[model samples]
Target: MEYVKGKPYFCYCDGKIKQYRYLDKDIKCEILIIGGGIDGAIANYYLSKDFNVVLVDKGRLGMSCTACATALLEYQLDDFAEDLLKHMTEGEIVLAYKMGIDAKGKINNFIKTQGNYCNFALRPTFLYTNSFFSIKSIKKEYEFRIKNGFNCKIFDSNNSPFTFPLKCGIYAENGGGEFNPYLFTKQMIENSKNQNSIFENTNIVQLIKNDHGYIAVANFGEKIYCEKVIIATGFNWEVLGIDDLCERFITYSIVTSPLKDFTWFNKALIHDVESPYHYLRTLPDGRIIYGGEDTIFKEKPINENVSNKKYDKLEKDLFRLFPEIEGETKIEYKFCGCFGSTPNNLGLIGESKIDDDILLFISCGANGIINAMAGVDVIKDILLRKNNPLIPLFSP
Candidate 1:
């Protein structure tokens, strides 16, 4: 569906995984995951430990939307607790926030044990705004965090430690993380228990229901008989043939060439309160990865003309934020990829509405990777027929 466009930074990074063979023969398993992006990698990594799982991708793994992900693993939702109250209760909001924190911990633990090949590191999170209209909302979010016992410091213009202008903001110490998304996807897939079952360039042409389960026919006529299926194709939902899965958007990003002595307070993950807001962080290589400026995705193959304009806007925005590097730094990478958002800022991570046997592991919103990391447990609990408090929050 041409879900991604332009040269993505992460895809060109080191630690790329070796290619997997296509489906040359029929296969069978307890659960069959139909995508090899980061979402599918997380699902397979966790679920395969308990269930018989197989993962297949139509193209190379982590080369699509996963490559373009900004990888800002913050525990904060796309919307504040105040705004999410319309769709979720106070308790649900708190739980979702906690889930985000726990998800970050999970990634940390994974890196600790699996080795930090993805350049994973925990960093502080800075949510700020220069607009006076946003101060109240940021304060409300800060108050919510305080009420929920999530330690964070609220900053105003007088107390701000950042170089950029800020009327108000919230700073949570080590409340977020950063990593190479493509490498992390590879890490998860290589560490997964079903390593031998992973396949690439195997497109499932059709899913035929059978007495036991369903038969997934590959493009080459090979078949996979599985009791359950997971569709983790990111924002590309054409495989489902069911539109309106979620509100889709094309989020743009630009990476700057390494600056010799450029940095912000604690090198924290910084995001603004502006609608279709912007985010920035320093890479391990001293470069800056900045993104946002999202536009609704009405169709695929992301328009180059629109993308080019967005890139221009993003470059200008970056310069506006850090005028010191305006003339010195040059943008090295420009890319845009599709992502989905739900009303609750949570992912569609449970059973499909059409059939319970068909699961959806699509992680939406800004904190998608975090959502997927924690939501995998919800999926596992469902597979085990156990109760999970997060089921209602992330369920499709």
Candidate 2:
């Protein structure tokens, strides 16, 4: 049923949709997708071209972490080069850099050709810190990027936009980009739907053994059968019996009212070396999103109420960047979200040992956009490594 008559709802918050009970029914599909997150959307895109597909969402599509996100799209993960390099070996660092670079193409290909309305913007990206040692090391990082074929430049505190401290900022040479993740992800979901099968506002309760493949037991004991299953339901793995993932909280985010464009910032994504390490960037509509309040409790966050602490911290953080905003616009909306993480900080993409052909996961920290695309191709090629040249490089 088309939802035109359906009242408009903000699925970003909990209790937005009616509690759906799964109807017990016998249904079949070649592939069943459990989560409606970005990774699930991308996986559905690839599989829809060939296999029969059925996608179920516990929450509205594209409105979970993807909507609540700070939405800064950068190749660099939480740690900047200076610190990340220390933890990584030579070959590992090279592969990591190459993987991020390759993710760029997978995400931007449609933007380059299909003219997607997803706010794809080109801006400069910078990393800065208060320590003199950290400031001087950016130059070394710039040198490393150039030596390794990445185009980068260095700017000292005196030479950079913010006048806070002594370190230099490593410019990403127009590599930084941002977009409306909700809109882009929603478009993909729409394209993934076909006449064969679809169910929304549906919640899967359990997974059980079945004769053909697997049986997804929804809330009301409804049975949906599929030959395979992929779990892209961000932060909801517990419902599907993945319990160990419930404790990992990788990062958090917040968005502020649009700030006046400045020649100083040069409209690029920014990350700094603070206690919680602030990462900031601009949305297409001019809002500035800065987050990374790291180092805290590990328990799952109970954020049913808006965080006054996060709001107050954001104000103080941005005031350091734009004193103008301190007296002007206040934070209009705020939400706290956490993602899954591992010790190595790389995505875990492959088969599940628990059940046969019953799982795939998108475990990258926040590189969902590009990683999702690359993962779709990798999952497809996993069964053909002997014949395919690129298969061994990404094999499980």
Candidate 3:
């Protein structure tokens, strides 16, 4: 699928970080990772430290959905704890939330250890209700989070920072952050330069499993032999013929020019309880970035008219939330991309059901990057023949 439309803000701002040669000659490795986006980069970073790993992508690294991603690193799931209780046991819900918290901390530590080349910053997140009726659900969610040992606070309309109507909200602490995803992916790939090989513009056309390992054929018929394969192909995992486990949607976003005053946002990641909700955050450069307005994916072209309407709606929603910035902010960039969400809003990460030798990493839902990092940790443990208790939680 065409993951993104128009010029993504990350690519426009950072340009290409580093280029890799296409895979022309046959290669062999202990581990092979397909899809060099953020998930692939994370796998490479972790796997290369102990094993010989080779990463390949059909296009430039970090230029896929990773570039278009809002890169909000938070532990909050798109499915709240109270909602998940209907389907999952209390123990299961607690475990999932705890893993999410661990994922956030892992990402923060990884950014710090990697020298923070991605403008990583830890911040709080505010999830508010968009309507008066949503107040009850948000309150229950806040109480559930607190009861489960998560750091969260409840705020009513009287205490909310917004001038607009907000019935109530959950102010979650120590579990939210933002980062430049493109830069982070590039840096991770760069760090693996010595221990691993990375190939771009190389498409894996076929995968054949054998008694010993697997052979992945490239577009040019070049073969890659590896003991194991990791598919980090984001929303396009169906290329491997795996089951369509996620529902897809198209999401729109816009970035404004550096604002003189963004203190009203308090640099907190803001989202709401509404379906197809709007989310807003600020960049270190004082620019405002917001996304939402999702629609069912029908494979329609994002023509000029569609783009204009989506951008207009996003802008109108922004003004509704913060009217003070109506005339002060000028939108500098706008784009749309494909987003995927599972039924339970958790990622799919474990051994592929189609092939045991192929491990799949599909992080669907809002906390995608965080789930990707957590997947990396789980895959590493699997590689070392160690058991990760969180495996069953995200297993396919």
For model 2, residues 14-68, the per-residue Cα lDDT tens digits are: 3222223333466888888887766777777667877788877765666566665
Instruction: Compose the digit string of candidate 3's lDDT tens values, residues 127-245.
Output: 99868788888888888888878888877767876566778888886768888889888888888744338899999989998876899999999999999999888878656875466
Give the alpha carbon lDDT tens digit for every residue of 1-396 in model 1: 487898999878877888888889988999999999999999999999989999999999888899999999998999989989999999999999889999999998999899999989899999999999999999999999999999999989899899888899999996999999999999999999887899999988788888888899999999999999999988877677877899999999999999998899999999998987999999999999999999999766689999999999999999999999988989999999899999999999999997888999999999999999998998998988999999999989
Candidate 1 pairs with clashing backbones: none
Residue-level error in angstroms, candidate 1, position 190 = 0.9
TM-score of each: 0.99, 0.83, 0.95
Q: How far is candidate 2 from the true structure (C-alpha RMSD, Å)?
A: 5.2
> For every model in order, what is the number of clashing pairs?
0, 7, 0
Residue 393 CA displacement from its true place in model 2, Å: 8.9
Candidate 3, RMSD to the unseen true structure: 1.8
The pairs that clash in candidate 3 are none
Poorest lDDT segment (10 consecutive residues) of candidate 2: 1-10
Candidate 3, position 223, lDDT = 93
- Per-candidate RMSD, Å: 0.9, 5.2, 1.8
The TM-score leader among the candidates is 1
